[model samples]
Target: MFDKVLVANRGEIAVRVIRACKDLGIGTVAVYSEADKHGGHVRFADEAYNVGPARAADSYLDHEAIIETAKQAGADAIHPGYGFLAENAEFAGKVESTDGVVWVGPSSDAMEQLGEKTKARAVMSDADVPIVPGTDPIEEPDAVRTFAEEHGYPIAIKAEGGGGGRGMKIVREESEIEEQLESAKREGEAYFDNDSVYLERYIENPRHIEVQVIADEHGNVRHLGERDCSLQRRHQKVIEEGPSSALSEGLREEILEAARRGVDAAGYYNAGTVEFLVEEDPDRAPGERLDDDTDFYFLEVNTRIQVEHTVTEEITGIDIVKWQLRVAAGDEIGFAQSDVAFDGHAMEFRINAENAAEDFAPATGGTLETYDPPGGIGVRMDDALRQGDDLVTDYDSMVAKLIVHGSDREECLARSRRALAEYDIEGIPTIIPFHRLMLTDGPFVDGTHHTKYLDEDLDTERIEEAQAKWGTDGEAAASGGDGTTTQELTIEVDGKRFDVKLENPGLPTNGAGQQAAGGGGAGGGTTSASGGSGGDQAATLEGQQVTAEMQGTILEVNVEEGDEVASGDVICVLEAMKMENDVVAPSGGTVTHVAVSSGDSVDMGDTLLALE
Candidate 1:
C-alpha cells in the first residue's frame, strides 16, 4: 500500500476516505478550499493543505491546484472522492504521468470509454449487455418524435454527457417534446459542456438499481452486488440500500453478470457503478422484457466511488477505498468473486439541508451546536461537519449520511428508524422526518418501492398538512416538542430580512410533520402561522407571545408604536447562524414595541418586535 495518499475532495466522503486510509496505517493528506479550512475532514487528516476558494470551480475542480497540493505533501497517490474531479479523465491522466503520484481510481482510458453515455451504450450492447432502446444522437425534434412513435409515448431526451438527471427531459406528449428537447440541449451544454443529445424509451415506474464492480490490473473483474437507489427527488438519490428488494435471485445474478461484462469490456478497474433502470411492470411478457424477463436495462455508468457506497461497504466487509489504493499500487485482485461474501442488509439516508415540503429546496445556515454521531452495533453516521461550521450554498446540500445495518431487510428498516430517532441536528432544515416516515411506509417496508418512490409512494398530502401546521405557529413548528421550540421563523425587521431556526432540543423530533389525529391535545390548535381560518385559535401565539425564534443579530425593525400588522407581515429580520429569516406578524394587531435594531445580536425568546 502507498505510504501517503491525498483525498481530492471535501465533505463527508473526504472524511470517509481519510478514516479508511488511517485504518490501513497510511498517512492521509487532505485538500480543502477556503470554505472547508475548519471543516471536520480537515482536522481529521494527518496533514492538510489549502487549495483555493470555496467555489468548486476555483478549488475542488481546480486540477492544477489539487495536483500541486499532492506533490507538495509528497503524496504517493490521490483519491478523488466521488464528486469534484472524481470522473475527470484528464485529471487522472495528469496524476498518472506525474512520476510517483498515482490516481486511485479506474484507468483514464476506461473513464474515457464510459464517460460518454452514447459510446458506453454501444460498448455495453457489443458486450451483450441489455441496453435501453434509443438513437445515438437525435439532433432534431422530428427524430425524437419518430423515436417516440417507435418506442411509444413517454420517452426521454437526454444529453450525451448528462448524468444525475441533468440535461435530461421526459416527454409524455408530442407537443411537449420540441421545447423540452431544446431545453435539455441547452442545460447539457451549460452543465456538461456537451450539447450532443440522445433519446431513450422512458421506463415508467422503474427502480434505480446499480451494481458495484471492482477490477484489478490482472484482468480479474468482480461485482459487489446491487444497491437499490430508488428513493430520489429530481433524479438525485436520497436513500439507498444494498441487496435490492426488487431483484429475484436469478435476476440479481443476471444484472451482476451484465455489470461485470460491461466493466471488462471497458477495461474498468478500481471503483465504479453500472446503473440500470429496472422496470416494475410485472405483467410484461418475457419477450418484451430486455433480457428474457429481466426488466432492467442499462442507464449509464458512474466511473467513480458513488455517494451511496457506504451501504455497499456495510454489507460486504471489504473496504472499497482500500482496494482502490491497492489497485492503484499495481496490486493483484485482493478478493475473487467467490472470496467476497455479503452478510446482512444495510441502508443509507442522505441527510441534506433542504426542506422536503417545499420541493426539497436547499437551505443554508451555520451550525449553532453539534452532537456526536450515535453509536451502536449496526449504526454508522458519516459527517464532515462540526460545531460552528457554516453550511454554505456553494456546494452540494447533503450534510451527512446515516447508515444502518442489520441481519435482514426488516431488521435494517427497524434499525434505521431507531437511528433516525437518535440522530440529532439543529440550525438548519433537514429531511430526517421524511426518512422516518419512509422507514415505516407500506411500499418501502414491503419492498415495492421504485425510482419514483418519492413522487409516487410519498404521502405529499400528509407532508403538506404537517408543514402547514408547524411552519407558522411556534407551537406547531416542525422542531417544537418537549416544551422546547426549534423552528426558524423568517421575519422582516425594519426593512431587512433575517433567518433563524431551533437547535439541540435533546429528544429531537424527526420531521414527521404533525402527530397523528388526537395527537397534540384538546388545548393545542394546528393553526397556520400565516393568516388562515380553521384552527381553534385565531393564532397559536395568543397565549404565547411571539418572540425572536432563534439566536441572531437583528437586521431591522419594521414595526412602530401602534402600527397594526396582519399575520405573515414582515415584522423584522434577524440574521441568525448566517441565515436571514423574516419574522412575520402572528396576528392582525398593533405593534406594542420594537425591542431590537440592526446589528443587535439576541438569543431565542428575546423579543425583537411584539404585536398586541
Candidate 2:
C-alpha cells in the first residue's frame, strides 16, 4: 500500500513492476541512464529521473544514485527487479535503513544465509529438504580434493555467491581439480566478488525445478507450486514450465512441503524460490533408486522475484508483484498453502536478441522496424522494448519473455509453437527459430527433457536440418532479399548470396531505405557533373570500420593477413552483444587484414576487417 515505489532496475522487468504498481493505485518512479532515455520502461513510469551516463556502472547499478532517486521521488519502498541490485544484500540493507523506504524483498539476514550455497544447503537439509550430498564450505584446496574423492569424481566447484551459473567449474577427474578450482575461484571473485567456492556432487542429467515461496510478516509461508526450468543452454535456462511433468503427486507434495519448511526456518518473507537439481533417472530398477527418493537437492534460493515468474502467474492467476508490495506494507500471507491451485500448465521462453546458431550470443540493434508479438488466448508476451528504440549493448540481452498457458503439457507445447511462429521481430537476430525447433522436438514433446536437455537432448542434426530448410548461412541470411529497393540498390531477399543489384542507376535523392548498391553514378563510369553523383554521402563510406551490432567486448579474430574466408567463417567476436557474431567474409576472397582487434567496438556494420 505504498503511495509510491521506486523501480530500481531497467528493461522488461522494470516495466512489469511499474505496471503492477499502477494497477494498485501506487505512484511509480523510474531511473534511467542517458542511453535509456527513450527506453520503454522510462516512458512507462509515472515520473522519470536521469541517473547517469549510459554505462550500467554509472546508472542502473549505482546504489547511491538509486537511493537518491527514491528519496527525491518520495517513494515509500524500492522494488529491485531481478538482476542488478535485486539480490544485493547491501542495497536491501540500505533501503531498510532509510526511513520510510522499505525494501520489498527477503531480509538481509536471509539473503546472507541463502547467498552462501553451503549455508543454504545446510539450512535446507536441517529443514528436512532433500539436498545433494556435498561438503559444506571447504576451507582449503585439499578439502575440495577430499570431497571430490568421496563424491566420486566429476564434482562441481561452485561459488558461494554464484547465481547465474557463473563462478562454476566441473572437474571430471583428479588431475583437472586444481585448474578448475582456480578458475572457479577467479570467476567467483570476478562475478560475485567472493572467491570462496564449494564442491557439490555433480548431478548428471538433472532437472532444474524450483518452488516459489511467498511469506508475510505474520510468519506465514506458502508454496506456490513449482517450475521446471530444465531446458537450458550453457547453464542458462532457456525454457521453463510449471508443475514439472516429471514429479509425481507424492513427490511434489514432499518437495513443496520441504520448501515451505526451509522458508520458515530461514525466517524468510516476501517472494523467493528454492531451486533444486532433480535427478532424472528412469532406468533404475524399482526400489533401487536412491535418486527417486532424494533426487531433488537444494541448488540455491533466489531471494527475489524470478524472471520466469510470469509462467507462475499465467497458470495461477496470482500477482506476485502485488504480493511484494502488500508484504512490505505489513500484510500477512494473503492465501494459505491450500488456497493455491495448479490451474493448467504454463511455460516461458526467454526471447533474447541473440543468435542461436552462434551459441546464443547476444545481439544489438536499433528499435525494431517491425515488432509484432504473438497474443491470443493462453499466450502472453511480456516486454519493454519497442520499434525504433535503440537496443543498446549496455544491458542484459533478453528483451522479452514469451509465455503460454494450456490445459496440459501437450496444449502448452502447441501454444508454444503457435506463439513462437506468430512472434516476429526485425532489426536484430533472436532465438525465435531456435525456440521454434525446441517446441517441435520429440524429447521436449514427450516431456522427457532435463536440465541438460539443450546439451544432451538437443538434436543438432535436426537444428541443422531446420537451418537447411531455411537455407544455409544461418537465420540472419535466411530472411534474404525481400526484393525491395530502399535506395538505388535492390537487395536480394530470397537469394543465397548478398547480391545487391542496382535497378535504377542513379544517386539516392532521399535518405530512406537500405544502403544504395553500386557506385552513385547515373551510369557506370558516367560520373554526374555534380562532382560525386551522390554528393558527400559517398565520402562518408571511406575508412569506416563496421562495428558490432551489440554490446559485448571482442573475444577472437578469425581473419588474418591475406587469408581467404568464405562468406561465413567467423571474422571476429563482437563482444558488445555478449555473442560472437562472425564478421563473416562479407564476400569470398583473401582477408585484407582485420580492421578491429581482439578487443574493439563493433556497431551494426562498420567494415570489420574488410574483404578484398
Candidate 3:
C-alpha cells in the first residue's frame, strides 16, 4: 500500500483512481488544469493542486508542473488514469528517476519498447501471437506501394508512435500511395512527435477486440479475458463488451492466452491491453459458428489503463487500478492465472458530448444541466461532472461512461437499453441516441456488427428520431432550467475552504466567465456565456440563418454578405475540441449577413450568416 497517490489526469478516469486509492486507505492528491479546478474529480480527492492553464499541453501534459505538484503533495506514487501522460514513457522515466516516487504502470523501458507499433509487432510475432502482415519503419512511399501491390488495395499506413487511429491513413489505389503515406507520417510527427510509420494489410470487416492482461513484477501474468470493441466510428471505439458474442469458446481462450504471452515477452507489468482486429469473413453468414481457423491480427498495445477497463472489471471482479498501485509498490500479484475468473457479459457505452446525427462531431460551449445518470443492480456510471459544469473543450469529448452487466449478452443488451433510457443530460448534444438505436439494431443485438458498422451501415435518420424522442430539449438548459439567471457569490469561512450553494445570491453578471473559490482550490472552468437564441427562428424562404451547430472557433469563412450560394455550400468551418466541422448554407440564396470572421469564436446556435 502506498502512502499517497497523485492522479495526473482529468475527468472520469481521474475520479475512478481517486476512489480506488481511498478504498485502499491511501492518501490521494489530484492535479487539475485551471479549466478543471472546480471539476468533480478535484472535489472528490483528498487534496488538489493546480497544475497549469486550461489547455492540456500547458496543464495535464506539463510534466514538470505535475512533478512539482506530486513532490509538493509528498505523493509516493502517481497514477495516470488513461490519456494525458498516462502512457508517456518519458514522463514515467522521470517519475522513476525521482527518489521515493513510483509510476503506477509498466516500467518506462517496457513502455518505450511496446509503445512503438513496429517493435511491438515484432515482439508479438516472436511470441507466437498472430500479427497482421506489415512492414517495419517504412520511410518511403515506394514501400507503401510495394506492400499494397502484394496485399492488394486498401493498405493501412499507420504511424509507429500513434494509436486510436490518429496517425493512420488508408490507401485504396496506387495513385494515393505517395500522398497518403506522407500525410500519415506528418500526422504521426504532429501528434506523437515521431515521423515514423508502417504499412499493413487492411483487414476489411474486422471486429475490434482487445485482451486485458495484468502482470506483476514477480513474473506472474493473468488475462482478464477479451473485450469486443468492434462497435466503432472513425476507428474510435464506441460500445465495448466483454466475452464477445462472436468469439467461440476455443477462440476466446486462444486470444486471451496470446495476449498474456505477448505482454510477458515484453516484460510488461501492471495493467495493459493488447488490441486485435478479428476478421469477419464475408462468406460466413451472420450467425455462422467460428472454428479454430478464425483469424485475429495484432493491432497495438495500450501500456496504461484503458477507457473500457470498467467492462473487464465488471466481469472479472478485479480492481485493476488497485493492483497497479500494489504492483508498483513492489508487491507480487497475489492471485495466479488460474484464480482469475470471469462471469457474465458486460458492456460499456462511452457517453461523449457529440452529435451522432451529424457524424458524431464534438459539441462545445455546452453545460451539463440535468446531468442525471442511470443506476440499478447491474448498471455502473462513471462520470466526473456536476450539473452546472461546462463542457471542457480542451481535451477528449468523452464525458462519462455507462457500464452494464448481465447473466448473458442478451440480458446485457436489455439492461443497457434500460440504463441508457434512464440516463439524462442537457445543454448540448450527445451520442446516447446512437447507443439507444444500437439496442434495436439487428447486427449489434446479434453480435454481428463490425468495426465499420457505425460509419458504413448506421441509419442517420433513425438516430435523429431517437435523439428527438429521448434527448432533453432546450428547456433543459442550465441550473437555471426555468429560463431565469444565475449569480455567484464567494465568501471565506475560518480561512480553511469554500463550498458553493448557488441556489440564489443576486442577479446574473452578464456574460463574463469568472473563477470562484471552492474546497478543491478554485471553481469550475473558464466559461464565457453567450446570449441565448430564443424564440421561433425561420428555417425556410428568403431569410435563412446559417448558425453554428455547436460551440467552436471559426477556422475559415468561405462566404461574405451579398454572395450568392447554394445549399450545403461551406459558409464557415468551426473547430471544436480537436475536430473540424463545416457549417453550410441551409438553402441556395444570397448571403444577407456575414456575422463572423475566420478567427471569431462562436457558440452553439450563434448565427454565422444570414441568407436572404
Which structure among the candidates has the greatest TM-score? 3
Q: How many steric clashes between backbone atoms does each model show?
A: 26, 26, 0
Q: Model 3 lDDT vs. the true structure? A: 0.81
Worst 10 residues of 2 by lDDT: 526-535
Q: Can you write out model 3's per-residue Cα lDDT over 459-481, one digit (the tens) per residue?
A: 77888677655544222112242
What is candidate 2's CA lDDT for residue 153? 77
Stretches of candidate 2 off by over 4 Å are 282-294, 464-475, 478-612
Name every residue pair that clashes in candidate 3: none
- Cα error, candidate 3, residue 597 (Å): 17
Maximum-lDDT candidate: 3
Candidate 1 vs. true structure, TM-score? 0.76
In model 3, the runs with Cα more than 4 Å from the true position are 283-287, 474-612
lDDT of 2 by residue, 447-512 (tens): 777677787667577764553232222234333333323212345666754634343323332223
